[model samples]
Target: MAQCRFSSSLLLRLRSARRFSSLPNPTTTQNDAELVSNILLHHHNPFHAMESSLQLHGITLSPDLLHHTLLRLKHNSKIALALFHYAKSLPSPPPLTSHAFHLLIDIVAKVRQYDVAWQLILEMDRHNLTPTAATFLILIRRLIASGLTRQAVRAFDDIETFVLTRPTAQDFCSLLDTLCKYGYVKVAAEVFNKRKHDYVADVKMYTVLVYGWCKIGRFDMAERFLRDMIERGIEPNVVTYNVFLDGICRKASLHPQDRFERTIRNALKVFDEMSSRGIEPDVTSFSILLHVYSRAHKPQLSLDKLKEMRERGICPTVATYTSVVKCLCSCGRLEEAEDLLGEMVRNGVSPSAATYNCFFKEYRGRKDSESALKLYRKMKEDRLFAPSVHTYNILVGMFLQLNRVEIVREIWDDMKESGAGPDLDSYTMLIHGLCEKQKWREACQFFVEMIEKGLLPQKVTFETLYRGLIQSDMLRTWRRLKKKLDEESVTFGSEFQNYHLKPYRR
Candidate 1:
């Protein structure tokens, strides 16, 4: 379904391209301008193509021709900017519309060219043309995003006076949501308070405020917004309640003792209120509850909620299943976790990295190296979940524990084949494991490989190698290793020398 949606969207874009192609070119001569325009349309380096067409073929490009070309390349800001510069340099500059300026400004602002974009705005003002509200919004969003909060606030403060269009609830929400997301909840509230009267406030705007306040742990402010929404005769929807529930549960987990106990009770009260208010609890609602229980270490309650949710015909999602699996693992119910993993797969719910990691973790916790190795193989064979660095580390460690050092090389090869080869930790573990088994030759080889890759070996790694060589009475190998270390510019304290000469014993 996702692939189909992507394909459909791509087809729509191709159709749009065709429509763009059919538009009348404003250039005088059809041949030269048409070629440049076509080059801009099809060629990867349209700017270079346009220059080559001009220099090599003596093609004369007018600003009007470039203007039409700019329209085609508007989706690509970098290309549009280049084309604009090319057009602006012509003897007779094309008559660009205010709308065209807005598109240019918007594209530049998106790429964080705040200074350049602001200069364009000033130029637009010098021409006595007012920027559209969309342009101001884009600039304000960029300023706020790039840590220029004061500038953003100032711009937003003077937005109504500058931009002619009446600000809509959407503009307010866009700015407010952005402000809230970046830990500027107070600024968001201030913006809301200042602009609420200008635009007809909607449920989404109120919810944004509520979510923002809740995110910053200001439950009082969040509730005040909720009440304001209610007084304005706006019915709070499922999303609104879900925000409160998620906030409450998250806040509950932060408390330590008595406060922690009460906060959880309060979360449960919110859940009860949700049901009492006749808003059917969806997967999100249940996921929040399950997550809270998992955090609180109440796996039984999480399982019970899962069963109850199933009975209510609310199918458990991958997130819900992952949390439950984690809880089961934490509570030492490995068998139940495995059973749930099977049920999850059978029900068409693909296991995530976390789900597989849970089993790996439990097996490792129980010191069952063979079981962990089998689980690692199953995870790779399934191909549904991508093995992370932790997965490789665990499998490599398991091979070492089982005294199967020969298999370690094969696992390393497989890890590289999977495209997430050994990180520093992987090399360290492999080198340490090989040294422990007195595989001095392989250890030295891996050590050199690690150094060549620019992954500096740890002090422990050097100690392990030096100690291993000394213990095996391979003094010649130790001297060669020390010389290699010197050549690599890897420094060590004089203390290591004392240890190296001390003994060959463990």
Candidate 2:
């Protein structure tokens, strides 16, 4: 039975290895340079130009010229394919080399025309021409890049038939990475163990497996792979340890409702294990533990980790400071968070958008709009962290609540000028505020603008508009808007389920 299986496999390989295409000689163009120039000039209309060149101008299609033209349209698959089809339209098609065919296949695959590309391969096979291994490798990699990992695996399965040379470890690693990326770690592991004897297992291969195991929360299997590497005399590097540390920390510190304390303890144990294994903890190691401590609300422990990193001559990264800042903000230590922000800048670590958002959120919660505005100006002046839509939304909403319409308008204008263009929520808030103030005309204008921008106002937004129209006695305007909205299939309803609208107690 084993002999029969081997024979069947051999036959499959031989059949798959048969030539995909063999083309007879085609007509040649007199002036290759002139034809190429004409093609280049009309690359945007590649197919049309190719047709005109052959059918109208009586210029024969040259494979070399077609190859050059296709290269120019490499980024645009549709145009390249059009040119390809035009070349094949001639009585004697231009002779396409293996590289030319590979380029066309790659361009077609990039645009996700897999069916058409497969048909091209079948046509190639009909012509008794075989593609090179490089061609298959390019196709496989592109397929994986396009998130067609299953197809890539199929391609990988039959890759042996295309390439004449031995497959490299890099090639196998790419396939393993793709498999692991899509949560096929078990299959990847099986393939690795089975094929490790065929190709020498490099550190990257081991790392890929360890990462895959850790990614799926299979730390036990990850540790087993680590031990397997050690047994084979392959020492786990800092990257490998970081992966393990990150996994353990993610489990322990992230979920407060879970066994948070136990997880933190587990993470610490992994950290200590790294030290015991003579692998010195790096910046990433410290960052992971600090993040765990911060998320777990252990601010003192997080601060201590920061101090330890500093004394050890390991300057804190932006992430390390950000974690501590976030912890401080969560604990309502606003003053300390502010001071820490200054210190972070002194240490040459710029605050990220998240850092600014955290402080802005706290300030808005406390109704300290003055402080928030100052922080906003400071953020703008610093220009390190560009303000996001959330930042603008908070400021706009706060100003509206304070009945500062002019200030809100200024901020809105600034938001637009700053390139953080208003989103649906921004327009909603603005329209709601304007309606509350009985500014029906202004509110209607904004509503029109929102609709023009393809932003559908929520039911609350329509309610606000309706109430404003009733209060302002704009029945005609309200009727027109209602008619338009109904025509657009917009149904008016209550506020979003997540939000409860309170009634006015007179």
Candidate 3:
């Protein structure tokens, strides 16, 4: 019986080695690329030409090849599932395994096919495959990311039932981190309390719970945990203190009208409290201090802290430098920002997309699209990193401000092709920018596309489009949309609510 067992151990290794997307890997050899393209060309074939390609290559179905092909075709679920079914039916080496099923399950889950995902999970039993912790993590993380926190909780519950094993501390910790990071801190606290007795509660576990409360700016609850943990004899660590410090800054950010000096001073109190407790500040603590000053737009103070790090023989991270860079950029000190950017690169620190975005924003402000696009060209040549959604959003906004609709459209398509896909902000900015340019029909098209993609447009998005159509005497278009809403679109949770149109002279 043990001899027939199959798992995702090798599959996990393969997955870790590759990026997750439906795009072909850039590093593939010409021959391998040709084979992938050939097999994918016949993706809709019922007989599964993937097997024929394998036979032609005289290569048995290996885990590496299987993982590669599935990821490459992830967007085409029909072909990916067909490949999975063919692999399962194979009576030879590389027999049906948990990895194939899990990968397919994740693919379906990405498109919100939860029922199909659950069925795939159940089907694993027929193959004598046991779902592992990684499997549940994928499900839980995706569900939470999709704003289905309750469904994530259900997946957490199903872990013990499906895996035939008890949930580990790591599983619980991961769930808590996901939930808290996504603003489900209350639910995370409930889970922690519900299972406190199942394992030996330690400082780390309590710290996770404390971090969750502090994460959401619930200092009262966080302090309660500190007292409770101490009473339980579990001492708080530097990380626990750092959570409070970070939370203080996060809370300060919520009220932009507050005095920057007062906010910065109050945020530093957390660090003072840490020292009073005999907890020495670590690199993270200094990073948080830099964030404190940066958040208040105090670039010189931020730079002072960077110099202090060197004076104390402490090495600063790329993020540390980026904070000052960002602060300088926001303050219109582009030369200083550039100096720091070059200094970080000289120190062998690679700037992230966020670091690059600071410069783009300054150029966009100065209407220097030439310099912005030039920097993007350089970024395209840099193989180590790629543009992310934020980068695309900046470009979209920059082009839209110049009324370069065609260029904005090209950027929209390019960002989508890059595979990060548009988030809510992307769609929102694009639609409104189109409306501002009197492109009502195009704006409506994107608004509906946003809805179809499972992203709910803001109330303001609908209102802006409505006003644009009405003010432009595009009543026919407005009537068409209203009819569509009345006949079909309202059922989609009335994504648009009842709002006063106010589309005419009052």
Output the number of the lDDT-best candidate: 3
TM-score of each: 0.65, 0.67, 0.66
lDDT of 2 by residue, 311-409 (tens): 999988888888889888877898888898999999899888778877877777788888888887776786768778887898898888888888798
CA RMSD of each candidate after superposition? 10.5, 13.6, 9.3
- State the TM-score for model 3: 0.66
Instruction: Show model 1 residue runs off by greater than 4 Å.
Output: 1-113, 120-138, 157-163, 254-260, 393-416, 419-506
> How would you encode candidate 1's per-residue C-alpha lDDT over 292-313 as one tens digit per residue?
7777767888899999999999
- The parts of candidate 3 lying over 4 Å away from their true place are 1-60, 76-79, 91-93, 108-126, 133-165, 254-262, 368-506
- Can you write out model 3's per-residue Cα lDDT over 360-390, one digit (the tens) per residue? 8888999988888778777777653677899
| Predictions in order: lDDT | 0.75, 0.74, 0.76
**Residue 185 in model 2: shift from native, Å?**
2.7
Lowest lDDT 10-residue stretch of candidate 3: 3-12
Model 3 residue 163 distance off true place after TM-score fit, in angstroms: 4.9
Evaluated at residue 438, the lDDT of candidate 2 is 76
lDDT of 3: 0.76
Q: Give me the displacement of residue 269 in model 1, in angstroms.
A: 1.3
